[model samples]
Target: MENRELILSIKDLQISFKTDSGTVSAVRGVNFELHKGETVAIVGESGSGKSVTTKAVMGLLASNAKIEQGSIYYTWNDFHTGEKKEVDLVKLSEEELQKEIRGQKIAMVFQDPMTSLDPTMTIGKQIMEPMIYHYKKSKKEAYEKAVELLQLVGITDAERRMKNYPHQLSGGMRQRIVIAIALSCDPYVLICDEPTTALDVTIQAKILKLIQDIQKKKDLSVIYITHDLGVVAKVADHINVMYAGKIVETGTTEEIFYDPRHPYTWGLLSSMPDLTTNSDELYTIPGTPPNLVKEIKGDAFARRNQYALNIDYRIDPPMFDVKGSDTHKVASWLMHEKAPKVEMPETLKQRIEAMKRGEEV
Candidate 1:
C-alpha cells in the first residue's frame, strides 16, 4: 500500500458551526487518507460527524461554519504537463474552489436526489451543466457527453430521458441521474453522502452496486459517509469508525469487521442485523451521543461505553496502534497493555465465527 499514490490527506480537521445558542463542534481533529482508486467509508450514528467531514472536503459547509484548524491536501496530476500538484483546499477561496476544484477535480453525490436535483430543469440539462461550467465544453459536446453518462449509469433510453423533468423519473432513476451528473467531469475523487438513504432496500443494493461498478470502470477514489455497517461491508476497502465527532477506529475492512478494537465499533457491528440473529430483540447501542455545544474533557464515548476504564473518563485516549498490524488503530484505553482484557459479547463472537464459516450472518 505504501507504493500506492495518495490522492487526498486530511490532518487535524476541526470544524464548528456558530448557532444562535452557541457554537456546535461538528468535526473535532478528524484525520484520514484516501489513496488512489480505493473506497473508504466513514461510519457512525447521526450527529457523529460523518457527513460533516465529507461536506468539508467538498467545501459545502454552511456559511456559519468555521474551519478553525486543519489542512485538506489534494494531489492531482496535470494531464497537459504531466506534473503532479498538491494544493491545500482549506486555503482556497470559495471562487477559486468553484472555478478550479469543485466538479472538475472533486465531485459529490448528495444523500437525497430530490433535494439535490432541480425540479424545473430537465435531467439531461442538469447532467450537462457541470461539463459546460467546468470543462468549458460547447452545448453540443455537453449534450453528447450527457447521453453517454446516462448510458454509463445503466439508464435506458438515455436520449429520450434528456427531455424529462426530475419528477418524471422514478426514485432509482433519479438517483442514477445524480450519479451520472457527478461523474460527468471525470473527477479524481467522488464523495457519496449516504447516497442510498432515500431508496428502498432493493434499490439501495442496486445503487451500491452501480457505484462500485462505476468506480472500477473509471478508477475513481471514493469516500462514503454512511451509518450503515452493512453498506460499508459491501463497498469499503478501508473503514473509519467515527463517534461523537472523532474517529474511534481506522483499519482495513476485514480488520474493522472481524477484529474490531473500539467499543463503539463493536456496538455498531453488533447492531447490524444478520440472518443468524435469532434473538427476539435487536441489539442497539445504549445512550446517545454527547452534546457538541459543551466542551468535552475526556473521551466523548466514555459515558456510553460499557468497557470504558477510569482513565477513559479522565483523559481522552489517543489513537493507539493495534498489535501485529501497523495499519489498524483505535482510540480507546482498552487497547493499553495494563488495561483489563475484555472480550466482545458472546453473540457477536458467534456471529463472526459463523460468517467466517461462509454462513449467512
Candidate 2:
C-alpha cells in the first residue's frame, strides 16, 4: 500500500477535569494520526469524549481540564523558527499556541453558529476576523477574501449574506458562514465539532457534501466530531469509535462499519435506525455509559456488554492488532485468543452486506 503523508500524530493522550464533584477523565490514552488530505471521524454518543479529543487537538480544551498524560505531536513549518520540527501540542504555552497555531495553522468550525457567530456583527465582519488577526490583512483586503470564501462554500447571495445577521439567515446558511470563517485562514487542518448537528436531514447531506468538496479542493486534513454513524460512513476515510473517555476501536471506514470488534462499537452501530427496515420498532443497545467521576476499571463497556468475558471485570483490555491493516486496532477482550466467537447483531451484518452491494443501509 502507498504511504500517505502524515500530518498530525496523537499518542497516549489523556485529559482530565477537576470539578467540584471529582476529577472526571474526559480522554484516556487516546492514540491516532491524521494523514494529509484525509478526513478522520471520532464517532460516538453524547458525553463520549469525541468532542473533547478534538478540542485537545485545537488547544480548545475546557479551563478545568488538564492534559494529564501523553503527547500530541505535529509537523508544521514554524513561521518564527523557519524550520519544521515535531512540536508537542500538549507542551505549548497558551500564549505561544494562540499566537502561532490557532486559526493560522489549525482552525476549527464550532457546532453552533449562534454561539460562535457574533450577532452584533455582520457575517462579513465575522469571517474577516480570522484574516485580520492571522494574516494581518487590511479591512478592504479581508472583506474581499471573505466574499470569495462565502462563494466557495456555495452561498449564492455572497454579498447579501455577508451583510446579513445570524438570525436573518437560515440554519444551513449560518453553517456555511461558519465554514467560510474557518476556511478564511487557509488552515492546514480543520477540526469540525458537529458542524451539521442543527440542520435538517436534507441540509445535513448538502453540508456534509460541501465539506467533502472543500476538503478535496484544498487537500486539507480534517478531524470530524460526530455521533451519527451514518454521517461517519459517508464522510470519514477512517473511523475512531469513542466511548466513555477512551477510543475503543479505530479502523478504516469499511472495517469499522463491517467488522466492528469492540462491544461499544457494535452497540453504537446496532442502535442506529435502519431506514430500510420494514419493522415497526427500532433497535437499541441496553444500559447507559459509565460515570467518568469514578475510577474506570477494566473495560468501561463491560457493564453493558452481554458477551463480556471474565478478564474484562478485572483488567482493562489493551489495544489489539487486527489483520490486514496495521493501522486497524481494537481495545476489547473479544480480540483475545481465549475469547469465544461472538457474532455482531444480525441487523448490523445485513446492513454491512447491503453496503457492499451498493444499496442504502
Candidate 3:
C-alpha cells in the first residue's frame, strides 16, 4: 500500500443540512483514501452518508448543506510537465473547482442514467460537451473523441448512437453513454454512486465489468458508494463498512470478508444472501439506524450491535489495530485485550469457511 500513489485523500469530513426540524448531521467525521488504480467501496444501508461523502468530493452538495469540517485533497500527475500537483478541494471556490478539478481531474457517474443525462440533448452532444468545455477542444475534435469514448465503453455502432437521444436508448445503453461522458475528459479519479441501482441484474454485472476494465485501461482510482455488499465483493479491493454516518470497519477485501471484527460488519456479512445455507429464512440486521438529528453520545451503532459491550453505550470506541495485519482496522472495544472474548455468529463463520473452500455462497 505504501508503494502505491495516493490519488485522493479525505480527512474528518463532516457535512450537515439546515432543516425546519433541526440541523441534520448527514456525515460525521468520515475519512478514507483512494490509491491509483484501486477500487474502494463504502457499504451501508440507506441514510448512512455514503452518497453524501462522495457528493462532497464532487462539490455537488445542495444549497442547504454545510461542510462543517475537513478537507478533500486530490493529487494528479501533470502529463505535460511530468510533475505531481496537489490541491485541497475544500478550499477551492466553486468556479475554480469547475474550471480546474471537476471533470478534468475527477468525474462522477451517478445512479440513474435517465435523470443524469439531459433529456433534450443528443447523447453525442452530451459526451462532447465536457471535452469541449474542459479540454478546450474544437467541435470536430470533441466529436471524434466522443465516438471513441462510446466504443471504449463497449457501445456498438458508436457514430450512429451519438445522434440518438437518451430516451431512444435502453437502460443499459443509457448507462453506457453516461460512463462515456464521464470518461470523455480522461479523469484520474472516478466516483460511482450506486451506479447500477437502476439497471437489471445482468446489466449490473456487465456495467461492473466495464468499469473494472476501464479502470485498468485508464489506471483510474475508483470509489464505489453503495449499500450492496454483493457488488463490493466483486469489484472492491478495499472495503469501508459505514454505520450511522461513520466508518466502523476498514480493511482489504480478504480481511473484511474472511476476518471481519466489527459487530456492524458481522451483521452486514450475515445479512448477505447465502445460497449454501440450509435455512430458508434470510438473515437481517435488527433495529434501525440512529437518527442523525439527535445527539449521539456513545457509539452510534451500539443500539443495533448485538455484541456491543457496556462501554459501547457510554463511550465511542476508537479505531483499534487488528492483530497481525497493518491494513485491517475496526472501531470496536472487542479488539482491546482487556475486553471479554466474543465470537462471531456461527453461521457467518461457516459461510466464510465455505467461501474459502471455493464453494459458492
TM-score of each: 0.98, 0.96, 0.98
Candidate 3 lDDT by residue in tens digits, 41-143: 9999999999999989989999999999999999987899999999889999999999998888899999999989999999999999998998899999999
lDDT of 3 at 204: 98
Q: What is the per-residue lDDT of model 2 for residues 202-267, given as tens digits with 9 covering 90 to 100?
A: 999999999999998998899999988889988999999898888899999988988888878887
Ranking by TM-score: 1, 3, 2
lDDT of 2: 0.87
Compared with the true structure, all predictions reach lDDT values of 0.92, 0.87, 0.92
Q: Model 3 TM-score?
A: 0.98
Clashes of each: 0, 0, 0
Q: Comparing candidate 1 with candidate 2, which one achieves the higher TM-score? A: 1
In model 3, state the lDDT of residue 185.
Answer: 92
In model 2, residue pairs whose N, Cα or C atoms come closer than 3 Å (at least 3 residues apart or on different chains), thus clashing, are none
